[model samples]
Target: MKPPCYLIVLAFLPSFSFCEIVVKGDGILQDTSLTKNEATPTKPQASKPDPAGDDLILFDNGDVMHGTFGGIQGGLLWERKDIDRPIKFSIPAIRQVVFKGSSGVVMEKETSFITLVSGDRIPGKIVSLDDKSLVVKSSVVGDLKIPREHIKSLSPNPFDGELFYSGPYNSNGWMILDYRKTKEKDKAKEIAGEEKKPKKEVIQENGKVKEESSAWIHSGASFYSLDNRALVYPDANMPDIGRLKFKAKWKGRLNLTLALHSDFTRVLPAEKKEEPKAEEAEEIEDGEKPKAEGEQKPRKKEQPEKQDPAPLQKERLVDFRKNNAFQNIAWINPSKRTHADMFGTGYTMTLYSSYPNLSRNYFSETGVARTQRMASVRSNISLSEGGDAEIEIRYNRKESLMILFINGTYAAQWNDLGGFPGDGTGFGIVNNTSNARVRISEVMITSWNGMTDSANSMIHPDRDLVLLGNGTDRFSGQVIEIKDGVALLKSAYMNAEIPVKDLSKIVLKKSTSTDLDSDDLSEDLTWAKEPMTIIYKPFGKIRLNPISAERNLLSGNSPFFGEITVDLSSAAMLRFTEGSPDLSDWFDDL
Candidate 1:
């Protein structure tokens, strides 16, 4: 059988974004972002595990707690444990819960169109709006909280990557700085040529000609990629990245910073050499003019010696540590000035700006305390008057770098002195205009774990334990020490070691938790050791290494229970205590 012509055509169209290239029966498309090809089918498939990344709970103050996610039990957390004294949270105290991976998620975006008093529009999802503050979420930048007074009104908006704040933006969650916006070029030309028309067509409104033909000028701004050709479509509709941070040292070692690279090539005129004076001297040795010979051999103007063009300036690559480092940064607004920023080791700081086109200068705090003085930055970067732009402000404890790119070109990079930034460093936006207000779609302060190359692995199981002598006997706790293969278990009441030979079933805990178990657990306390679930019941379902169950009595090792030979004849079950690398590497592998 022959494939349909359109399917054959689709095979060659490089413009399409099909995940698979196989031909279809009638050319009908298939949605296979998830699952597998249907050609090989089985009776049925088993239920899948949660597809998100690590189950992380972030605190409002910037601290993070990792756990296996024991669901809320009796208004208390259960399943896994890794928390400090009085392990408790009201659920509302959490800033957000970042799931394990992006699988099973729709990846759809719901945005809020914030209309500032200046009539500017920005898009994001409204997380909260109260008298004190307004918190918005972006698939790009995670969550952003702003002061209430800084906003005027908010309305829902459809998520379109290139629609408003998407073009040329990225998943890093663009902070649309609507400093200025300009109209389309054709509209500008139409208005320029409008004056040439008949006087009768030049009707004036509000002291200006109302040229409907030139209306396309204010159709809102658009953006292009670094090449300035393909329209940029920042995939900003992610569920929640939590943060976009990397280590001060990991700038060039990871995907986020490595992807920010841009190169520049410049050509300079060759140096001119002074021509010898002897030619002119020979032309007029004596002041007297000689009689012209018949058609005096036309002395071709002595061709000046050809000077070698100065070797083309070597193409330059952006250095995150040097001056004008942001020369390759991209921008969406139009400005004529540029700024510079610096970054080194230890501390980190950055500046964000959304300035009007006429505002020739902006200021930076770098990493220093404000002395009521704003360090002005003169910029050579420009975008449309009403469009927005963002800057990359990376700071260390001793230095900070601020880079701004505009209209697919490097604009400015500002460096200053201050402490390096840690997690949860907050930032804000201030409107310098009264009637021309702007909306800051996001105020991103990046933070993540892979910012360094230290040898230590930052991940461990949230909780680890073992089940011995038939599933009925269980012990949950940390493995403090191992001696000659005999593992030591540290539980609340006792710390004992169990031999490897006695092992029946061992469920590996995947997260590290700090919450202390209750000193008084019911004899029936039990939990299933799944990826993100807990089980606590059904004595018949319990299975484990065979136990010499002389009647109901069973033997297990314990510290507090003392007697080298412990018996579980009186209890129902047992429990244990719970919970980085490549990367870019998943934590579950360990």
Candidate 2:
């Protein structure tokens, strides 16, 4: 095939430049973009009004945008919709704003309290937040329990300065800015103590204005210092009233606050054990002889325990395999339960987590190939034939399970050994083959890569773009390699690989990184219409091969294999699941 030529494209490859851009909101734009029919929900695509656009606007928080309507306004993109209802929020709430670098969108609302895209509702006061989670407090909900990844946006009610008891035991009173230093407050107290006569202001018609005492807690990014501050215990009896003082900083080195003095007894070391030791070590002189390695045994490094990477929720794939004896007859029931399954005389088979090479010969109602063969290996569960088959696989933080359905009826069950060689530990599926006629019409897998809801939306790129490592959206890119069951994307600036199952939605967007005229830019993904080639080089070495169901798997009636080679590199991959296989079975049992 001739390499089609076009003018030089603005290659924003490997340059993961940090920039913020504007996302403009044109009033009442016709929203014709179709919702991607993904098992998992995804972020909506923006309709490109005109391409050839230049001058990307970066937001205050370092987000960049480039489409027809893109720009930052007041810490958020102006392009977002204002969903601030009168009762929900007096402060304006932006509905939907696209995050920079990828197609993720952030949604905001008010009075809805706190509901994450994942469906967890956190009802309480939001004390603090970051990109991934938030800390909230409520008597009913107790404390911070929601992660930011689950949230779409935060909606804070407008402060009315009215003290209301929102919690079971505490009242969120009016926030008065008490800027007076400790000395100034002390002087006021001394003066109040020196009063000789009954104070007219303190006494009302029936009673005196009582002084309110409570701890002011801030959970912002700054580190807090609790120096000699005493927390009053419920059981402790205090003499009339007493006070405690301490300081805390947000995202800083030290905390500050005045010491507390009270008759109520609650005593301990002022600082935590680790914090003081760290401080003490820093104060040691440079010339002073350090303790011998054995004398003062060095503290063992507390390595951040490696978290088992998130699990990949996979579905089954039933295609043709060369080594399998049942090439003509798709195993109506393959004993290997975890990976792929077949039934309906090979006409209708279900694929669970991964796609496999398949042939249409088995799909025909009747033929010389209408003969079934035993599975290449035995699966923990046996598969039975008759009627259309469906494979259901579920994934969680740890493992994945597979279930088989015949003619939409329950048939078989299996636990994926997890990785190849049945370690039951790895993610993704490969190194196996199946032959069936049915087109893999359905594939459902749980994912963490991208999620969507009223509050948050994430993008799960198709196989090609995800391998780019940088996670930037490119208009024209191709699949170059499948290493260790992972697909690698090749482009001028980007060279990265991703798990094949990670491909949920592939989007084609107008490249807005460099300066170009609006007339030259096209919003639709015209390039994607051409066939994408997945080059396979021994699943380890870089190679190119057109990954077409027809080309490599079958030519008319005969099976053929071809090979091409290429150079490739690396990219980090993140997998997440929406549901667990165990949960699916348990729910089914109920």
Candidate 3:
């Protein structure tokens, strides 16, 4: 059979002539024309001022363009101010797009979210439900009748409370600072003491000096860090009981530090005090009596007592050092190390990836405190090399407990024996890898009830699972119907009507053929002429084969959802390509 007409037309496109697209294991798309070198420096050059436009597109090689979205047809059409004709980009050449002024959909009071078996999540109010199909009233895309077999779990109150933040829409208020540079400055100050001249002045007095640049680059909705750097959201007003969710993609080993309840706007070095010499200490202790004899005590005239600069006063320095809050350092793969600290108390967790993958956790409360081994088990939560994972952290300061979930699996939980430290509401992240590239996006913080999912619970292979609010109560049953915020479940012992608010999660019986894994979905997309993953706003993802587009609507065919049309405005991101690098090769090369 001959190729499609659009493919024939795409062959003649001018943009394809000079641009060579390369897709990385982390799903980053790079245009060789925009990048002169494939290797990134240990400390990258300072990023230019963000371009000005209503919409922005980020290329994989850290290049960005300010333009207007021209919608998607056979490929993405981006209209630029410098060009009269719209430039079409293949899916593999674009990282992400940020639509200016696009806010998250405001969910109604009665709204709930459903997670499909294909990993798609949709927010809507349940109209009615049965074993065959679920009718839902979506505020954005109108009513949707989702097949019952595709349903995985349901959340009655996904947010639990109002949404606090759902962005990384732009880098407007974000502070990206080079971690190494700040530490170096702090070290230099500590060694040189307060009497040393300022670095800028010293440079002027000596010779021209080079200034360090930030290791992170912000393009559109994502932040890419070349070396160690800290991305801080100083304005975050974290709820006492809240959940933080973000998607991170990185190349090479994943080493990251997540700080919660942090008040640190910028890194502040710890205060250092010099010890007095033996004679100086004795003379000071002796006061004016002993100093009279032959010492003289430099008594020409008593000038005003010298004082350190205002910013370096003892009280001010102490206040600055106190801003360092709870932080978790997580390193995956070869390192297989994790550490969490709050104030002076914390724990270190080590992991082994192989069979009997024994993990250990050791807690320390103080220097003289007894060491405690809280818990240890063989965990299956292993992060592959050069792979991406979704990291979710939920903290309940009221309960002094924090839970971590990796790729939807319960990894571990920690209870702060010293109680949750710091009342500050800021959140921050540090890229701990030296030369690897890290990309962070889709960051969202929302008020939570501080409940953990039942991913660790045991479930019968043939029965549907229902978990209660307490995080431990659960049962296996057949879900007959769901209505009026109550789930009707028929179990072996009795039929119960469980209130939705009392439930934490519901996992339906898996269908062998209907439930498609992500790997399976990616394999099917390989055959499509133009395959794209449309990440809808609020929540949800759908893989579609683009047929055509008109105005703001994109009509496409999903192998799983069949014929469908998506409003371009309702989408948060559009991914053109998928797949991770081979794990064996990555490990061997490392």
> lDDT of each structure?
0.29, 0.24, 0.57
What are the root-mean-square deviations of the candidates from the true structure over C-alphas?
Answer: 26.8, 33.7, 10.1
Please write out the lDDT profile of model 2 over residues 1-590, one tens digit for every residue. Answer: 21122111112211212221112222221121211111111121222332323212222222223332232222211222221111111011221212122211111222113444322233345554433345655322346444333343232321111111111111011111112233568778877765853676454325534432211221110111112111111111111111111111111121111101111111111232455666577777554676876697668899998987344322222222222111111222222221112211111122332221121112112111232222222123333221122333212223323233323333343332421111111111111212211111122222221111101122222222231212233223544433454545666777766553333322221231211234654433122222212111111111111222210131111011122211111100000111211011111211
For residues 1-590, what per-residue lDDT tens digits would candidate 3 score against the true structure?
22244334334444553264222222222222223223333233333433334565656444555567787766678775545577677656666665654655666655677877656676677666687887777654467787787677776666665578776655555554322233567777866873486867755645534344345555434566655655666567788888788887776766676656654412222356888889998888778554556654565776888885344211111232223321112111122122222211222222222211111122232212222444433245666546676777777888877777776777777666656544657666666668566678778888775457634453445788886755557788898998887889998899999987777667777642253545555554233564666665566566677777654677777655567777677666566544431111222322
Each candidate: how many clashes? 86, 63, 0
User: Per-residue lDDT tens digits of candidate 1, residues 1-590?
Assistant: 44456535444433322223332333433211111112111111222332322344433232333333433332223122222222334443333333332121122333234433222233345555444555655432236554443344443322211121211111222121122234578667878887786665667646554521110000001111111111111222211111221111111111111111111111222356888698788767776466676756656798899986444432212221123111112222243112111111111222223331211111232322111222435365333333444433322322343343333234444444432222212221222222232322222233211122111121225444554533245577755543453556777889887763354323333332211254654333222231111111111011221222222232222111111222222221221211111111111212
At residue 383, candidate 1 shows an lDDT of 34
Q: In candidate 1, what residue range of length 10 has the lowest lDDT sum? A: 214-223
**Candidate 3 lDDT for residue 204:** 60
- The segments of candidate 2 whose C-alpha lies over 4 angstroms from its true place after superposition are 1-31, 34-76, 79-361, 364-590
Q: Which regions of candidate 3 are displaced past 4 Å?
A: 1-52, 58-63, 81-96, 178-213, 219-222, 247-254, 265-385, 450-460, 468-475, 483-486, 498-504, 511-513, 517-530, 579-590
RMSD of 2: 33.7
| Position 399, candidate 2: lDDT | 36
- Model 1 segments more than 4 A misplaced: 1-53, 68-70, 74-88, 103-304, 311-355, 358-590
lDDT of 1 at 192: 81
Candidate no. 2 TM-score: 0.17
- Candidate 3, residue 402: Cα displacement in angstroms equals 2.6
